[model samples]
Target: MTTEHLDGNALAGPLGEIFAVDVTTCTGRCASCGLTTPVASLHVYGPEPGLVARCPGCDEVVLRLVRAPGAAWLDLRGTVCLRVNLPD
Candidate 1:
């Protein structure tokens, strides 16, 4: 079976809320592949229970975010680190 997917741009809004920055332009290192790339280049799936972002290099789940009524959860286990250039 084929699962539908979208680019990381879809996550910009939700991630912006959590990061308070433009995450789509940020770079992230994939823990599984050790590859560094722009977050906006990753693959994104779902607005169902939450949003899932996967690495384009190794297909590893790089990030997962869930927003509840009064709470929110963010997982970055699959990402080693993220590089964001904060504005001056």
Candidate 2:
């Protein structure tokens, strides 16, 4: 018998989502001064290193903040529908 094989990754996109903050979207507060400032550039945020300020809306806090929990995903191959369960 003759057969052909295909690589699943052949269809993957060249640009995958980078888990990072968009500098244009980052606003932080100054720890030394009571001021809300936008991050000058994206280079400021690296992988859990260095220091940046907090949300400017609240000067009492600095740029450092806890990360939110991510949405849980279940891989159900050949599934035919959608389902979601949120806690109370």
Candidate 3:
């Protein structure tokens, strides 16, 4: 069977709970492939062990988020940098 996945836009709700900004609109560069794209453009999978987002260019994992009781863990080592837009 094929593994089904969703676009990073799915992260909005989960990430919104943690950040004040819309993180899905942020651009993140892949540490593995150096491809830069919006977080909303990445491929996302899973909500069981948490969410895993991968780069569209190389399919390398760019972000991972795990939520537990009263806490959330976010791993972004696969991402070189994230560009978040701020309102002036």
Candidate 4:
């Protein structure tokens, strides 16, 4: 089966609920290919089982978010670092 995906901007709503700032603006480094880019540039798929964001450069899974009844799970193992901008 073919899987269609969206840009990481789709994660704005969900991620906004958990983070104080806009996560889409954050820069992420892929652990696999060492590619670094804005989270908004990553490709995102799914919202049913959860959301998975993959690196655009190497197509490696960069981030994963799963929401349950009262809890949420986020996996960033594929990302070495996430640089989020903060107000001074």
Report the error of model 1 at residue 7, Å. Answer: 0.7
Regarding TM-score, does 2 or 3 come out ahead?
3
Tens digit per residue, CA lDDT, model 3, 13-68: 99999999999999999999999999999999988889999999998899999999
TM-score of 3: 0.95
Q: How does candidate 4 fare on TM-score?
A: 0.95
Rank by lDDT (best first): 3, 4, 1, 2
lDDT of 1 by residue, 1-88 (tens): 1277899999888887778789899999999989999999998988878989999988889999898887789999999999998989
Tens digits of per-residue lDDT for model 4, 7-40: 9999999998889999999999999999999999
- Clash count per candidate: 0, 4, 0, 0
Candidate 2 lDDT, 1-64, residue by residue in tens: 1123122121111101222333333343344453444443212221133222223334232322
Best by TM-score: 3
Candidate 1 stretches with Cα past 4 Å from truth are none
**lDDT (Cα atoms) of all candidates against the true structure:** 0.89, 0.28, 0.94, 0.93
Worst lDDT 10-window in candidate 2? 7-16
**TM-scores of all candidate predictions against the true structure:** 0.91, 0.24, 0.95, 0.95
Between which residue pairs do clashes occur in model 3? Answer: none
Off by over 4 Å in 4: none
Pairs clashing within candidate 4: none
